[model samples]
Target: MRSRHVSVWIDAPPDVVYAFAADPHELSRWAAGLAEGSLRPSADGWVADSPMGQVTVQFSPPNTFGVLDHVVRLPSGEEVDNPMRVVAAAPGAAQSEVVFTVRQRPGISDEDFDADIAAVTADLQTLRGILEGQ
Candidate 1:
C-alpha cells in the first residue's frame, strides 16, 4: 500500500478546527472539489459526496478526529479505495495542526499517484484557509 500524509498548522483553536473537520457540511465549504455532501447516520458513521465522488466514514471520534473510507473512481474507470484519516492536534491554545493521511491501494501508477497527491494537497490548502478565516 502507498501512503501520503499532509498537514497544516492553523491559527485557530483545536476545538474550532476540530469542529469544522467533524461537520460533513463544512467539508464542501472548504474542500474546493467537493461540490456537495451530507452526513448520514449509519453503522460506519457519516457519508459524504463530492464532485470527485462519494466516501463513507469508517471511524470517527466525536468532534476531534475521523477517517473516511474513500473510493475514488478515476476517469479511466479504475477504482482505488484509499482510507484517509483526519486528525487535529493542539500544541498551543491558539494554534492547531490538522493532518490528513491517505493509504492508497496497490495498482495505481506513479502518474496517477502524483495527480492524487496534488488534488489532496490543494484540498488541504483550501481547508487551511477556511479554518484560519482567510
Candidate 2:
C-alpha cells in the first residue's frame, strides 16, 4: 500500500478542532464532495451515495489522544482505513494541526492517487475554513 498524508493548520485549539472532526453530523459541512453525493446514515454506519453505489463510513470512538481514525467500506467490500489526528502547536498555543493519512490500495493508479490526495486536501481546507470562521 502507498501511504500519503495531508494536513492543515487551524487557529482553534486542538480540543475544539478534534471535537468538530469527531462528529459524523459535521461531515457533510466540510466534506463537500461526499455531501453533494448524498451521503447519509445507514443501519450500521454512515453511507456515501457515491457513483459506484453506497459506501459505508465507520469511525473510531472519540478519544483524548486526538485519534480520529475511520474506515470507508466500499461497494466491493474493501475497507480503507483513514487515519486522522489533531495536535496542538504548543503546550498553550491556540493553533492546532489536523492531519489526514490515506493509504492507496495496490490496484490504484498514480493518477487516481493524485486525485484522492487533492480531494483530501480540499476537504481539509474546507474544515479549516469552517473552524477559522473565514
Model 2, position 3: C-alpha lDDT score: 89
Candidate 1 least-lDDT 10 residues: 57-66
Give the Å error, residue 119, model 2. Answer: 0.3
**What's the residue-level lDDT of 122 in candidate 1?**
84
Q: Using Cα atoms with residue i matched to residue i, what is each candidate's TM-score against the true structure?
A: 0.68, 0.91
Q: Give Cα distance to truth, residue 22, candidate 2, Å.
A: 0.8
Q: In model 2, where do residues sit more than 4 Å from their true spots?
A: 37-39
Clash pairs (backbone) in predicted model 2:
none
The global Cα lDDT (0 to 1) of model 2 is 0.86
How many clashing pairs per prediction, in order? Answer: 0, 0
Candidate lDDT scores, in order, read 0.61, 0.86
RMSD of 2: 1.7
Residue 74, model 2: lDDT of: 84
TM-score of model 1 relative to the true fold? 0.68
Against the true structure, what is every candidate's RMSD? Answer: 4.2, 1.7
lDDT of 2 by residue, 9-71 (tens): 999999999999888888878976444554577887888766446789998987998898998
